[model samples]
Target: MRLVFGLVLIIGVGLAGFAVFMAKDYIGAYQAQLDAERAARANAVPTVEVFVVNRGLRYGEQLTEADIRPVRWPENAIPDGTFRALAEIFPDGEKKFRTVLRAMEKDEALMQVKVTKPGADAGVSSRLSAGMRAFAIKVDVSSGVSGFLRPGDRVDVYWTGRGASELGGGTSGVTKLILPGVQLIAVDQIADSDQSAPTIARTVTVEVTPRQVAALAQAQATGNLSLSLVGAKDDTVSDAVEVDQSEFTGETVAKEKEVCTVRTRRGAEIIETQIACPE
Candidate 1:
C-alpha cells in the first residue's frame, strides 16, 4: 500500500508541473501580442469626422441633412473650408438650407466656396467677388471661341473698331486687347459650370470691377467686342496687344519730313522764308 501511494503522488505532481508550463507559454505569447497591438495603435494616423455628400449633387439644388454623411478623414490632410460638423454647416439651428454653387460627386467634401449661404439661391451674384459687377457681352461663333466657353472660364477681351485720325489709327479698324484674364460667371442665362456641351451663346456675362464695367460698356458701345479663350493653367500676364491694318499687311508707316519757315516783312507784304529745323 505505501508503494502505490508514493507512485500516485509523483504522477499527480508531474501532471500539475506540465499544466503550469503550458499555461506560462500561452500567457507570454498573449502578453507579447497585446504589446504589439498597443505599439501599432500608437503609430496609427489620427483622423476626424468630416461631412461629405451622400450622393451626386448638381448646382442650384438644396442641401439638407439627409444629403450628407460623416466620414473619417486624415486630420492633417483635411481640405480647407471643409465642414467638420452639422452645426458648422447649419448654424443658428435655422431651418434654411444651402444651395449648391458647383456640382459635387458622391463622397465629395462640402466646402464653403462650393455652396451658397443658407436660404440663398445659387446665382451669378454668388460667384462675384466683393466690389465686383456682372456685365453681359454679346458673342458669336467667331468671337466666342467657337462656343467652347463655360461659366468658369477666363477670357481676354478684344475691341475692334475705327480710331480717330488724331490717334494715328484711320478707317482701317484696330483690334486691341481691352481686358485680360476676366472671369466668366455665366454663359448666356445659365450660371452652372457643369455645362460640357458646346452651345453657341448669344450673350455671356463676366465678373469685373466697377471700373472694368465702365470701360467694357464704353468699348462695347463704340466698337465690336471679341473674346479669346485663355488656357486654364496659363498664368503669364499678357502684354499690350494691338494689331492694325498696317501691321497686319506688313506695311511700315512713313514719317513726314520736318519743315521750318521764317517770316520777313517787306513794305506792305509779309514774306515767309524757309530755314533748316533746329537741332
Candidate 2:
C-alpha cells in the first residue's frame, strides 16, 4: 500500500509540474506577442494629414499645402502634426491628393490659354502656344450649328480665292478653298457675352496664328464663313465641302423674314392684310 501511495504521489507531482510548464510557456508566448506589437507601434511612421475641399479651380493650378488638411488622423500616429504643416512650405505643385474642379468637364480647350511673363520662357510658346498675335474669330452657329459641338473641336477651314480649277475657266480665274483645316481651340461665346437663349448670339471663337489671323480677318470681312462641328481631337484637312451654304452665314437668323404685305378692304370697312414671303 505504501509503495502504491508513493507512486500515486509521484504521478500527481509530475502532472502539476507539466501544468506549470505549460502555463509558463503560455505566459511567455503572450508576452512575446505584446513585445512585437509594441515594437511595431514604435517603428510606425506618423501619418500625414491632408484634407480635400470642393473649390472651382482652373486647370494646371499650382496647389499649396494650405489648400488641404486631414479631417481625421489615427490615434498617437502623428507626433507633432508636422505632416499637415509641411504642405504649406512646399511650392505650388501637382500631387496625387490634389483635385481639379473641372476634371469631368473635359472641354479644356475652350478655356482660354494665356501666356504670362513667367510662362513665356517655359517653352510652351515655342510649340503650340496661343500668344498675343493670335486672333479669336467669333462665328455664329445657329439652328443645329452648335449641336454636338464641344470645346476643343477640330474643323476644316475653306475660303473663296483664285485657284487652278477657276483659272481653267474662260475667265482664267477660279474660286477655290484657300485653307482646308484649322484647329478649333474654343467653341464658346466671347467672354462676358450672353449665351443663354437661342435669340441671344452665341459665337464660337477660334484661335489662329498671326498669319492665319490676318487671313481669317480678311475672310470674315470679305467672305461668308461658317463652322462644321468636327467632334474630333485631330484637325481634319480636306478639300471636300461637307456643308454647302451661302458663305456669310451668321449665328442667328432674322426674327421676321418678310416685310411686304397684301391688304383688302371689305364692304363693312374691315381691313385685312396678309404678309408675303420674300421672293
Whose TM-score is greatest here?
A: 1
Which window of 10 residues has the lowest lDDT sum in candidate 2?
A: 107-116
RMSD of each: 2.5, 18.5
Q: Which residue runs of candidate 1 sit more than 4 Å off their true CA positions?
A: 93-95, 163-172, 265-268
Output the lDDT of residue 76, model 2: 63
Give TM-scores for every candidate, taking all chains together and pairing residue i with residue i: 0.89, 0.40
lDDT of 2 by residue, 124-229 (tens): 1222444534345555544226544443455555554333322122221223454555554333432211122333225544546678778878876765555544
Colliding residue pairs in candidate 2 = 50-69, 51-69, 65-87, 140-251, 166-173, 166-174, 224-247, 224-248
Please identify model 2 stretches exceeding 4 Å from their true place: 1-133, 142-148, 161-167, 170-202, 233-279
Position 115, candidate 1: lDDT: 92
